[model samples]
Target: MAIDGFTTCLWFDGQAEEAAHHYLSIFKNSQLGHIVRYNEAGPGTPGAVMAVEFVLDGQKFMGLNGGPQFTFSEAVSFQVRCADQEEVDYYWDRLTDGGEEGQCGWLKDKYGVSWQVFPTELLKLVTDADPAKAKRVTEAMYPMHKIDLAALRKAHAGER
Candidate 1:
């Protein structure tokens, strides 16, 4: 069952169920919830999936087997704030598998969903009170696709 309240809806070209399962497999605390199918009323073939509701680590999202009319865009993205380098690497690798990677910790999942797999230390380093530390870290990050936490930490501490 979908928990009541705001739920993000992702439009897919017939891959809603597949994407839901993929996400469920990746996130430890997530689950694939209720699914709805198209009927003879016919936006899709009868008995085919029409939508799916899933929870990824407590975040609710609805996937619509909507068709080729709409597509995922980078204007909106899911940000995964990782606890450390391991978490960042885990998400970055999985999310970028068979998908394109973007600069600065962002990548498109195999299903075209944009995700930011970032280390929590990034926020701390980037927002540090020392302007030089923050700038160094920021500059170090802008050129990278998958975040390198060790490098960022070095830059933050004024080390090469």
Candidate 2:
């Protein structure tokens, strides 16, 4: 059987629709899908959004206006694989607009959503067939706040 893209559900206190719009604006290939509101017999307030389905970069996601019972945590995050340093920098800056930055290319967006904006080349280098090169790449990565591809490449070559 063919498998579609994964769907991630985000729970918001009262801004499911708003958040969906925000996300769609950020991602080039995103758009709002469906808007479902509560009925008299439903769980949420009658006119409030019960859930909003959206697609970001071809990945489906459901945003639920599930009240303020829960919030997002660092444990759950989205990984954006970038082709180069410029792409990595663009996502890293945009995602961390009003949030904190973590080590190793990790960041939390304004909505408290965690994201990992990393270069695709870094993965290949870290998993290189040469054990010494991989070890050097691993060591170089440990001290980084945001990924530096040049530094990583230099590390793999054992250059100062």
Candidate 3:
């Protein structure tokens, strides 16, 4: 496929190929592109995978085996907007396998890449015109590792 927009590059110590495969298995609209290997390059063993390109849900990403000097941090994260609770649960469960859960629907995948997975309604609830309603929804989300859409809706509606 022709990549038209900016492609995200993930820096990995030596798991470029493995990470690409992991993502492929999770996203339905995904496919593997090219696998670039080192050729006589002194930095890595010849024929070893240097980088892997893949598409996840139409977004292009490249996994680079750039060594251990660089690592993924919370400074940057990808957000997954789910249509409903089931979508949120699917991503949260898969991405958090052998990984960590952060407050407010944030998580670090097994590869250390941070992600924000939540229902699409969250944006609407948190930004509601009614300040109190929005505040309640935001408060309810504060302590959650995986967002619960029903709970958030109840908070927005001022329900006990």
Candidate 4:
């Protein structure tokens, strides 16, 4: 494939390859592309992974072994929009496995990558034209970990 256009590069301390494999295993349409290793370079030990090219559900990404100088923060996150509660549960469970769950459907993977696994219904409910319904949905979501679509729907309908 031609190396061009936009692609996200995820920086890791020394687990680029491992993270790539883990991501590929989690997403259905994911695959690993080129994996480059460090030679007798001064930056890293020989045979250590330098960078890995991968595709997660069709989005191209590069995992760079940039050492421990930097780490991932919750400020940057990939949002996965789900059509239903099942999709939300699937991504939430998979991404949060051996990881941490944040408020309002956000989570951090084992590799410290932040992600938002939420259903589309939640968005619709929260953005409703009715201020009361929208406020209820927002209030209900504030205390959620992985997001409860059913609860959001109920809140949108003004039900407790």
lDDT of 1 by residue, 1-160 (tens): 9755789999999999999998898898998899999999997999999999999999999999888988888999999999988999888888888899999998998888898899988999999999999999999999999999999999998999
Candidate 3 has an lDDT of 0.95
lDDT digits (tens) for residues 1-160 of candidate 3: 8766899999999999999999999988999999999999558999999999999999999999999999999999999999999999999999999999999999999999999999998999999999999999999999998999999999999996
Which of the two, 1 or 2, has more lDDT?
1
Superposition error at 33 for model 1 (Å) = 0.9
lDDT of each: 0.92, 0.89, 0.95, 0.92
Candidate 3 residue pairs that clash = none
lDDT of 4 by residue, 1-160 (tens): 8867788999999989999998888788998999898898547888888999999999999999999999999989999999898989999998999999999999999999999999877777888999999999999999999899889888888888
Candidate 1 worst ten-residue window by lDDT? 1-10
TM-score of each: 0.96, 0.89, 0.96, 0.95
As for model 2, its CA RMSD to the true structure in angstroms is 2.1
Off-target runs (Cα >4 Å) in candidate 2 are 1-6
Candidate 2 lDDT at 75 equals 94
Q: What's the candidate order when arranged by decreasing lDDT? A: 3, 1, 4, 2
TM-score, cand. 2: 0.89
**What stretches of model 4 exceed 4 Å from their correct place?**
1-3
Predicted structure 4: lDDT: 0.92
Candidate 4 local Cα displacement, residue 35, angstroms: 0.3
